[model samples]
Target: MLQFINPLLHKVIQSISPCVLCGIDRQQHHSLCRDCWQQLPWSKSMVQRQEIDIQVACHYDYPIDRIIQKFKYEQHLHFQNLLAGALLQLRLPKIQAIVPMPISNERLVERGYNQSLVLAKMMAKALNIPIWQPITRLQQHSQKGLSRLERIDNIEQQFQINSTSKLRYRRVLILDDVVTTGSSIYALKQKLEELGCQKIYAACVASAEI
Candidate 1:
């Protein structure tokens, strides 16, 4: 009874609430009104990055880019629902679990959360799958002056297997808030492969120009 009532109550709240973007129209799609949602720089396509084809929901442009920056850096967690909704727009594959892009302990301490993990929690619940974190990320350093190869090498070293967990999933999806060069995803993928993931897939809320 509560389960049924919860959804209906949510729908009612959404119907009355103003769109997060326009702040005038009633919420329609994913906390946005019909106009705002349709205008969201949608991509809904696959992008090849580091030989991996990632499913992306939007082009990292306009309001989407700004929203992501706020959600990740500014602690505007209220935007998470809209961001998770964007990922839900993708045609995701069937996987046993979701692996959110891991952040360094240092970064987590500074930011108070791993943005990808927060989004992954929403996705895992919606998809009825477990959230898996088999990789731990070391402290991240800036790549401001590094060459491409050096940047890749630096990013690759950040991901280390979390040896404490014996649990492994043959199939999983890597969730990230954004994708640029895909260096981090590729690095993470290598680690997932080491863990014996047979069919590893990746998806992001938005993809930016490399």
Candidate 2:
């Protein structure tokens, strides 16, 4: 197992752990060298789960952006594990299910992949939470340069429940790679509540001001 071998392998990684973001030598556990970690813009506090709960580790900027770009767009799949480990450090509450933000059919067709799904899988593995695919994108629209109010309006009718199967009893955690306006999670949370989910949490790797 990787965990069983990690202690011994750490010395090896220390010798060879090149920074995925900056190319510096790293002696750390997950990924990204020490210099890069220090330079990352971390979130200052843990956000509460109201109708929805949001937990994020960092701000979406600088080195975090470059790393996400590499992982999501450049096909660096290994970075997902690194991100999952980083998120684990946040000490989130016990969760029943991990639900990733669903990508629209149009976007999936254009990009040939779903980055949030990948991140959710990684998080699920790290957190030992079952992934529940219970949300579907109901529509698609361009979201470039949209204000917070505009984003809320655009997402109001954008999502729907995938099923009525045990949704009423599940304590779900919504997973995403990033959160800018929190509109998408809010919309999805509203829909989940309508379906009778008692507790909903939103977990993302980073957040940004938009």
Top of the candidates by lDDT:
1
Would you estimate the TM-scores of all the predictions?
Answer: 0.97, 0.81
Error of 1 at 12 (Å): 1.2
Instruction: Give the poorly placed runs of model 1, Cα more than 4 Å off.
Output: none
The digit string of per-residue lDDT tens for model 1 on 1-210 reads 888999999999999999999899999998999999999999999999999999999999999999999999999998998999999999998899999999999999999999999999999999999999999999999988988889899999999999999999999999999999999999999999999999989999999997
Per-residue C-alpha lDDT of model 2 across residues 13-50, encoded as one tens digit per residue: 65687877667666365777777666668774566532
Clash statistics: count for each candidate = 0, 2
Number of the top-ranking candidate, with TM-score as the measure: 1
C-alpha positional error of residue 75 in candidate 2 after TM-score superposition, expressed in Å: 2.7
Q: What is the Cα-based TM-score of model 2?
A: 0.81
- The window of 10 residues in a row where model 2 has the poorest summed lDDT is 44-53
